[model samples]
Target: MDCQVIFQPSGRRGTVKKGSSLLEAARKLGVDIESPCGGTNCCGKCKVKIDEGYVDELSAETHISHVSQLTENEKNMLQPQEIRENYRLACCTQIEGDILVFVPEESRSTQQVVLETGKDRVLRVNPAVRNYFVEMIPASLEDHRDDSERLKAALLDRYSHLDKELSIDYTVLLSLPVIVRKGKWSVTATLWKEQVVVALEPGLVEATYGVAVDVGTTTVAAYLCDLTTGKVLQQDSMMNPQIRYGEDVLSRITYGMDDDNGLAILHQTIIEGINTLVTRLSKAAGINVEQVAEMVLVFNTAMHHIALNINPCYVGRSPFAPAVRKSLDIKARDLGIRIAAGGNIHCLPVEAGFVGPDNVAVLIAEEPHKQEKRRLLIDIGTNGEIDFGNKQRLLSTSCATGPALEGAQIKFGMRAAPGAIEKVRLDPVSLEPQYKVIGEADWFQPSQTIKAKGICGSGIIDIIAEMFKSGIIDPTGKFNMQQTSRRIRRDANNKPEYVLAWSEETSIGSDITVTQGDVREIQLAKAALYTGAKILMKKWGTDQVDSVTLAGAFGSYINKESALVIGLFPDCNLDNVVAVGNAAGDGAKIALLDKDKRVEAQEVADFVQFVETAVEPDFQPQFVQAMYFPHGKDTFPHVQHILDTIPTVKRSKLEAL
Candidate 1:
């Protein structure tokens, strides 16, 4: 039977066979839904909420059903994330009847958070584009120069250091006569780098604006900045629509290589999202869309390729080559971004491999090369980028941590949103759960409905780290299966699981539990991060992790105690571990605002030694050792304070009856 399906917000419509997955229908209708594992039903990134047309009350269905049964994968995936209430894994969920699907902003994980409120640096205010109002002699036959040559003379006379090879959009030549005459030969000219004229107006303009963009795998953040005053007028962000193709960069690369039009679709998705933001930010800031005269972007190499519509076929293959690693100046028009017609988009330099300008951007934001004390900068998202250095030199590396810690690929994992659990504490004596959700400040008992949503990256770290300290889980992240509590039980697969919340207590009508599989996901993610940092330490010939600065939204929200207890990275003084919010985005802004800062960013990116984890000889062994809690023996002198103060129970395994 053909069943009708509708996607909301976009108001897209389609039809599919009764048993077809929503992802399949979405693909048929050209709707974007991310499946990073290529729809293997492994990554839980393809989540969609059922808005209507499904019967949830399974009571006495008369031996029939409207919604198809959840696949074993979907059933196992939703419990830990508590998404079973109304959401389904779109890749695995089949439509049995007409239904409306509501895709949340978090499902794509592209919604950018305004991680910082204030600007970080001061600039010299020498911008590339400047508006000059010059009065020209109304041309007579005596002053026989053409309109273009006449304007060029007037501009050069006013500014002697102008480029001799000036160029401009043909439209500027097409409209120059009317503009010059309309202002009585006294017109305003917008010059870029004193080279090409980009815009012409009848009078003086107050400000020239620019945009600094962070094109992440799933999210994009844009800052509308005042180029003249170096003031941030406003900022905007949204899920990178490319998330419909994949939640991770490699998946996106596969999408592009697998389909001829995949590259175009990926390019169009991000361009549309950026254009939408440009319009929104301009209107909100009370500025004309054409006022934005320049843009700067920082992306991981894969995102950089996809954003520019370059074929990413070689990025994921052997040798791991990138299209280009140098800084580029691409015209916004060529990239199809909506801004001033002749505006330019400057991309900062990229390091080797997938560690592109986004990594460089974080370094620009952190300015590690300017510091004297040894420090470690970790920007962990679906992937992890590390920068370690002081004033002498900077060392960096990239690691594929996957999306587990970001809430995808985890059974009960979810983004930090309204009902998503962001904090957790397990009682030592009772082993009952106390947790907090996003959008709520106070801690609430998991016995309450709102407190029992699926866990987020930070909460996952907290629970596992706390379990290690409380003797519930061992250094290897194994559960003491002998526990007598009713909360611990064996699932149908005969694997041990711990219940975080009962069915009635959660938004979902089923218990939210962490399985043995869930623990492994955490182990894998944390190990990647720790190993990367340790490799740098090993290369740097230092056993000490002087300081650690966590970057990005997920890193900022993570509990430092939990991160330390789990050895998310090499050991550092607890107080030295700090969160630097959205360093990559901030780096883009720094380049956008300061010309000198852009040069510095390039120098730092170029000078820093980039270590590729894939080819590193000792990386595999470090990764294996890192899988154990607190790095299997790397003492957490800082974590000992919590272990001593907190009422941790003994590890006696319930006395074996």
Candidate 2:
């Protein structure tokens, strides 16, 4: 028997085998659903719900324990009431009878605007440390000594722990003799814990290991991982090396165009940065460079291009082309990375012209689009890239938002790091700003009072909200002189300044202020965001969305109120807006853990659609109009009432939180 499957959003219908899986039916019908596992159930991503159908619930009990974050009961419930409300794992569910299904908007996995959650397990430790199991021949009457004494005497007085009353697992004892005899009475052991010993050597061996890197344009992060067991050891992060050239891809592109050796220079800078980080990491781990056998490099298309010495000028121009969209595995030295010549460098693939390796890694990791519902994967950074797709069609695009969101270009913009203010709250009545910083733990006040170094993304949000509240900036992003406070001032540049940190309160000798130029920078940044989001919705043919994922450091730190007030994003469900921290890094970690995911990255790259924002005629005008602190209500009707409350002023405009 044949079955007819109908899709709502796509309005594309097709026929499939009677017993085919719902995912397969959707795919057959040209309906989009994100499936990183390629219809496999391993990822648990292909989720769809049946709205109208005569079908029984799944019988086999599928536990959600192994799955990340989900609980058993949440996993046990199989029937979905509303196609929008139902929870169905598409990869696992099958189509047994005629049915009408509703795919969740988030589960559809579109490329318009994606917000990944931050409950990542990348910080967890791996149980793959080295361990040694040694046993000395039982002391005879002739040797005549206690077990500890005899063992120490025979081992040339080495530091033996037998005297300390050590306990050993029987499993270790069971193979102790063979292991010792294999090494001629001496053995080196790599112990992860009492439950598992990952490695063993004929003699003494060390367990210091390798690291993974996601070298982003705005920020760089390194993960120290054990090579033998593929366990992450230590992780470190910093801003990218090319920031001095310019803030965003466009500026970097211009910088590259100006200098003949710009590409190579940018390449070498990143290499040196990574090498310096490697040296520091090795020193901390008490290991040499040789111990790091494998390293992964994940970044955007331009970053990958720069790293590989590819000319990125093409990416800056029409059609928004890239040098290479395919994933490649090569030697670290080939890319000028400092490491053993034998070390491997893995580069994540790219989806489209603007959607680069970062999106590829993210799609493969999150598998957000592996359902019948439409899904939007939005990566907010120097370039606000989006991916929209279901099981069949995928669209992708990039918004050239510049570096303001990441705190670059602003008078006091810095990456989210130590001494960078990350949290800010303005009292509705007082309009006083209270801020917090990121540290080992979350607390009201930081452990040590480091002077305010610079305003990071989170601080930018706070500044914007406070400016709006105090009436210092009107809806048009203009400054109002009616309200006065010590926080407001004028800088030498003859620009209006909002004093974020006092002269003595900051690390810099002078006061750290957010100037008018900074406001303009944020305006352009937010404009880019607005235009990109609007274009996608216009293209995708919908304004009302089920969910919007806010990823990266900026998304995590910025307050929801400030984000909405500044109009960084379109008006949507606040509950749907989630913060997924270090999504790119998390994607890299997923690839590291699962080797098969590398191929899935390529698939994700191939399926996404890229909308060229610069080339689009409407983009620039939308961008210009979006220059104000609050956008025009015509474009964003959702925030009309809020925009109406603020007066029209121009000096201290453009608040970006």
Candidate 3:
């Protein structure tokens, strides 16, 4: 039997097997519910409320029996109050009949504020795909040259700087005769590398379009560009559909290795995502999807392998070797991409381990290799990719920062969305905190009914730094039980936590807090990132960097002061730290507009050295010291004034326990 299921708020509806779990049904209907545990029912984050009402024509009594009773795991995971309100774990409950489930804002995967804009640089418009308008003489009995030969001759005659040996795509060749005849032997031929015909269109079609995509672990962004003008016409983004499979790269790889069809599912999902972007972008730009000639994509190694349908298990394993390190040119149709019939998809080269082409794209866009000053480029995300050195030399490494910084793995944490607290500041003496949510223009006021939901990555960093500076938490990230503030209290587990928003101020009907565990999760995540930067700096034999360039979506939004206070990287001059929004996406756009940049991307990938931080003997000590606020040993001279204000806790006192 099939059960009709409707997910509220989004109003997405679908039907699933009678035994299907709500999480599975949510996935089927394209309704995103956070399943960080991959639907194993371990995270208990996928909670959905079953409306206490009858379905269409069914009795309330009958509809109530459709949902499976909560199991022992749910009983243990969910709070008693939640169970009484009909809140059940989406992963644990099975649908026996029609049901309307309302996913709470905290459980629903909200649309994130994706970083799509980057610092644009002027580049020569030399795209690999070029369109040429050629007028050929009508063929007769005396001059019966084949359509392919006649088209080539006409192109050479019209342009004069033509490749004598021009090859037409088989699919394009099949339609060549009709297209040329339809326009009375006048046609526009789209060529790849000026040597192969990828598309043949009737009349003179001068508009050549391309899409540049950045496939992040959590989000995917696409930029539609006018190849002829080298200008971006439209841009769109969506959460990476693969996120439902796993919140991070390693988990997604495990899914592929464990499930028989996981790889295909992931690959198809991303392809469909890209196609959706194409359709949307083209429609907005007033063009057909077929007019989009080329695509350039960049992502980390795990995403690179999965998007290519290759098993990503090995990429996640020891000695992390990718299946391919060279740039590849695949047919758009071959990859299930909807574009010009014979268009090509260019994948930038990747470095070793998890450092893939996205990092290469970052390097290309930032041009760190051409600078005289030493630079540190960090693309902060679930997996942090760090690059160090300058024109003389370059090194790179990847760190498993997990999803904590992106608002995963933390209690009361959420992505950067409306109602997400994005900024926090604690008064030095009073320790009273004022915060700003994403949608609000001003700091939250007690007088106003601000429905703050949760703290996001930036807010998490800010709160932790403010806590340390204000003496609410010590350098060791332990709550100071001595504080008399009412905000400092114990959770149900008797663990210490700092309440950011009181129950009356929140939409979740509970106090939003920074728990002791949340602090630990951030500490671990930040340590991984800081340690990776430290390892690269050590390998480069430099104790300091001239500049720090923060790339990617999360990195761009992070407050430089907060980042410095948290010691996300080796301390540099505060003025030198800058965020280049979505540099990887910019690199993809550069590659799409210029053929030379693609070659430069490969060169950059090949030139950089990959450092395996997991194997470093000093990794543990560095990580431990980094776990402290602003680092235990490293000095941030720029932020030293702020540090001096902090009431230092004695190491002996901390270790005495």
Q: How high is each candidate's TM-score?
A: 0.88, 0.63, 0.95
Candidate 1 segments whose C-alpha is farther than 4 A from its true place:
1-12, 16-21, 27-38, 44-89, 92-119, 445-452, 643-657
In candidate 1, residue 270 scores what lDDT? 87
Backbone clashes, each candidate: 4, 54, 0
lDDT of 1 by residue, 1-657 (tens): 888777765677866898887887887776766566656677776778876434343221211144677678877766444443577888887778777777754454323333543235554576777787787778997888788887888877877888988776675787889988888888788877788898888756667889889988767888898987887888888877776677788877877887778899888888898899899999999988887888999999888888888888788886778888878887778999888888878899878776889888888777788888789999888878888878887789888999888777776777665667788888766777787877676787544445455777888888887677756676677888665578888886688888876777676556778878888999998999888888887787787867899888787888897888788887778788888777888888888877777788779877899888767898788888899877755666776666454322223223323
- Predictions in order: lDDT: 0.77, 0.62, 0.88
Q: Please, what are the lDDT tens digits per residue for candidate 2 over residues 1-657?
A: 765555555656655676576665775565656443344343343455555434233222222221223324336423223223555665456555445556654335332211223455543333223344454665457866554343334433343532343333333445555665677766654332222232334565655455667777766877776645566566776656565455567656766776687777777878888888788777777777755645667888888788777888898787678878788777565666665444557778876666777777667755765866556656788778776556656567788776677665565566565656666665544545666655424423434565566667777877886677557676667666555576766655456777765667555455667777677777777777777777776777776555667767667767876777777777766776777777787777666655567767787776666777666778777777677666664344554565555544222233431
* TM-score of decoy 3: 0.95
With a 3 Å backbone cut-off (N, CA, C), the pairs that clash in candidate 1 are: 80-412, 81-412, 110-218, 110-239
Query: After superposition, which runs of candidate 2 have C-alpha atoms over 4 Å from their true positions?
Result: 1-118, 121-210, 227-230, 251-260, 282-288, 336-340, 417-419, 427-432, 436-448, 484-495, 501-504, 507-511, 634-657
Which 10 consecutive positions of candidate 3 have the poorest summed lDDT?
Answer: 55-64
Q: What is the lDDT of residue 345 in candidate 2?
A: 70
lDDT of model number 3: 0.88
Ranking by lDDT: 3, 1, 2
Write one digit per residue (lDDT tens) for candidate 3, span 333-399.
8889999979999999989889999999999999989999999999999889999999889999989
